[model samples]
Target: MVIFIMRITWLLVASIFHAGPGGYLQYVVYIVTSLGFVRQSFDVIVDGIEQSIVEAHNNLRPGKIYVNNGDLLDAGVNRSPSAYLNNPAEERSKYQYNVDKQMTLVKFVDNEMGPVGSFNWFATHGTSMSRTNSLISGDNKGAAARFMEDWAEQNGVSKQKGHANSVDFRSLHLSSVLPRRVSTIIPEPNEITDDLMQLASSYVASGGRRLAASNITRRIRSTQENTAKFVSAFCQSNCGDVSPNVLGTFCIDTHLPCDFNHSTCNGKNELCYGRGPGYPDEFESTRIIASRQFLKAADLFNSASEEIQGKIDYRHTYLDFSQLGVSVSTSTGGQQVVKTCPAAMGFAFAAGTTDGPGAFDFKQGDDKGNPFWRLVRNLLKTPGKEQVECHAPKPILLDTGEMKEPYDWAPSILPIQIIRIGQLVILCVPGEFTTMAGRRLRDAVKNVLISGSNGEFNSNIHVVLAGLTNTYSQYVTTFEEYQIQRYEGASTLYGPHTLSAYIQEFKKLATAMVANQEVPTNIQPPDMLHKQIGLLPGVMFDTTPIGTNFGDVSSDVPANSNFRKGSTVNATFYSACPRNDLLTDGTFALVEKLNGKDWVPAYDDDDWSLQFKWSRPSKLSSKSFATLEWTIPEDAASGVYRLRHFGASKPIIGSVKHFTGASSAFAVR
Candidate 1:
């Protein structure tokens, strides 16, 4: 029953939070993926663990320290060597990491327990999904966080001390963008007005928040209503019987895994079993059924555990992986000094996953015996000659780490972080860690804490690896996986011992914390701030069509109009250059509700269901337009609503200026 609820909750998240412009098509793919089904259950288990921690430490002391000071997100200079032309050094200084932007204070909530909260603050780096997608988007992780923020705001929790930043609450929004093959795309539907769509989105966002808030019990109850609503609305025709053929063992003849039996896999790989698209596939169905039986059989441990008093502390530092060496445990009963190579990827990195197969004649999960791969490897791998030998078995395709003249191709300077609250410890990894690598790292951290010289830490220390955080360093796979030469293995930039090296460094950190000693400072990576560059030019200028003024409402819902359930609302405006002002911390548009005598914000650009699209009427015209839209769900309460657009215009030689567009009042009944 718990597993069933978990899968349904994932369906809600995939369809709402992570939905790109893909909409129904994307929904179908995710709902069917077996990976989503299984991994989502794990997410619930993690949540249960978290809830246990909260329940255990009900009366624990609130933390006095708030640690949101790492690289949260900043629009800084692109310091890649390729960004510079004539004078790389001079142009680079234009974009160095400023002290002000380095560690920003986004929001501070002073409470009786110091500052005890963690907002769904967006992670400041890219993931493998981001590297492949062309459209600008927040990965599933960020999208989930965005949903939490939006939901909190709607429920009057935005700035309320007891909401997102509660004195005794902390939530970890894990990314479940699954199937490992396809990317979730947010779609822009032209059906409804922005305000109506915002209302519809409130339904979904509220569902996401509930899902985030659930443990084992709450999930079971919430899933029935929320999941049914999502399927009814998004599934359209198939409603209750949507086909799960887009992924898993059912998706035969596709590039993704189809044989859950593992009979066809070369090495009988466990990863090949029941892995692919769709929820409740054969493997998942069986697991869910078994879980239900277990829940029925064991009622003794059903209640929440004793409250735990968790401590909240975090430490962050910079590490240069270029030449860092560590003593790794060896099978021969000794430790070996293994140094990480400069960042680089192999030929197989381009051979995308089975869910979304890549171009060319390449296929992943295969050895490098292919003639073409060998030829490409010999040609591209040998030219650099700088340090190709270090990242062996990877068949170095791009020696980005060693290439320095133009700009640093890959990051040598990366952020390493450890977040602790009570017995829960999160190793905030800056790179993607393969499944095995993550497990090993988690165990290593736990062991280090346990083996502290004086055993000063808590007896029950739990560790989880949170990857692709703070900064994007790329992939980290184990030596065994790296030798396999699959996409993840090839993308393991720092070489075979990357995982081992990370474990070693984390152990050192654990030891320091245990002994209550100051952390040792490592060599700083090269400063790209003075050497980075930006290729994309800034916005030139903005102008409306000859007669229209900027922010003019070109089209909108009728004045004093009424809309019904399952309808859409839309508004068009004479939009300006979006680049003129990125609106980093603000909204491009808003859905406002008429409350008493004043208007209240209901939704903004961050809402996935409310879309703001920018386009030009013609190729030769400098004028641009934006069509803001929303799809009203059946449950939207009858009320008066309006859409507002915020835009920016840059004159040829003048500073950027802001403008506004408002729609006529409308009613949803």
Candidate 2:
């Protein structure tokens, strides 16, 4: 009723303005204004504003943007492009204003201490193409641009600093978005995957991706194909009508109505959607920072000051916790898979199975005990449900349905449920692993974890150890257990293959997650050293800090030093080098210790195990060390075989090989 009155009042206002001319103009304004009353969806205003801007731009720069605005509003207000996005400036502002206003439909939140509300994150089926396809692409500068800039400043900043950086009104989040999954990257059209593709049809037959299908079915209420048809159209073409009264009218493809007030929209009502499941449903994803839900939350909060009045800050601020994985970028040939996080180029790899998949964590077959099958509501109620239960993957041999280990040591990363977090994150790989492939993949993962400000330990982050989860290299701790290779080591918990694989995924997801959680708070901006590098004691770098055992400048030292050809010496060295401006290079000058004078020597049992660019040098006939004037001293004890290692300034001497060093007695007798 109030909406009607507001519309009528608006119509009257238009009449009073156009009283001098014909009343017809007044009627038109009244109509559009009234139309705005019943349905004020974001797209309607965005499109209207966009049309206005484009029309104005066309007048100035013909066909540059190629969008026809068709005089939807009265004259005036030249829509010269924003110039930055290659579009109209005034017009862009107007459209942005309209988008900002309309997208907020119902502005509910308003307090001095920033914002707190939901914002809609636009999820796409595929491609980061353009606004036409509702993609996070093209020169259609919207929230994403702001998200990028805002995210950059949020890492380690104060409110004043963030403002100085324009972090509040920028799209820093969008600029740095990453894929949810490292492995699920779709191959090019020519490179359909045999693992997932062959199984696609089978999955469809058995209700493939059932949850996605169900959601869309509820929206479109049709088969996957028909549903896709509507969604795809909604993305590219305008769906809603200009008239405000009919929400469905605003949406061309979907009959589902959208009201600004959400008065008649029962989001919680099962029948709230216009469509439902029967269609050839397909689930495609593109990382969207400002979704509808998040935007709505923002709208309520954005109804504040004029400066920050436009967009919502909390929109897309948290993990989807629902869709844990992201898109993949597999090459057509499949020979080498390139791990990429288009969001965070600096850090692209560790996906940290963050939030372990999502709500649809249900599995197939039995519904009672299966963690996947047990609906979230019934999860706690049914049978023996606990963290320990998940570890016991129902026996392969019934009566002996027991774990390989009576009390299996569960790693912190993988959690069994979506409720309290799952293996901090789960990874889905596109294919098998190779040594070189693993390297590229791990590098990408490390980059991501380091770049993202999002972290773990504050709360249990359930990451998944899928793909090579059961088989690949074990996800190692920041400890050097992998190098130790002891039966009682931590690596033994996950085994080498599985642990390595999970850690790899965790590294990949970091950037996207951190960007997703671009909420400013207490956090040290990660240094250039990737994967939380820096000089932290337990960080991957410290545990496996670059070890260089082989001598680059080829020359023999003492007979027992690693310089000796074919020697099996464990090239290990730990250093506490002081920091300097110009990159410091810490070198180990391994010299033979002989009677207070250095004897350049080499060892016969060296393998260059801990050195940089380790490689086996040629054989030495003891003549090699002799060439460097190094040998047992003339009056030296027969048992003494010590070597001195000087790391720049600090000097420490060690026995060349265990139990073969100098005698304790130094008497000249």
Best by lDDT: 1
Residues 591-644 of candidate 2: C-alpha lDDT, one tens digit per residue: 222222332232211101112211112222111110111222122222223332
CA lDDT scores, all candidates in order: 0.47, 0.21
User: Which model scores highest in TM-score?
Assistant: 1
TM-score of each predicted structure versus truth: 0.60, 0.16
Worst 10 residues of 1 by lDDT: 231-240
Candidate 1 lDDT (Cα, 0 to 1): 0.47
Q: Residue 329 CA error for candidate 2 (Å)?
A: 21
- All-Cα superposition RMSD per candidate: 17.1, 32.8
Q: Give the TM-score of candidate 2.
A: 0.16
What value does the lDDT take at residue 550 in candidate 1? 71
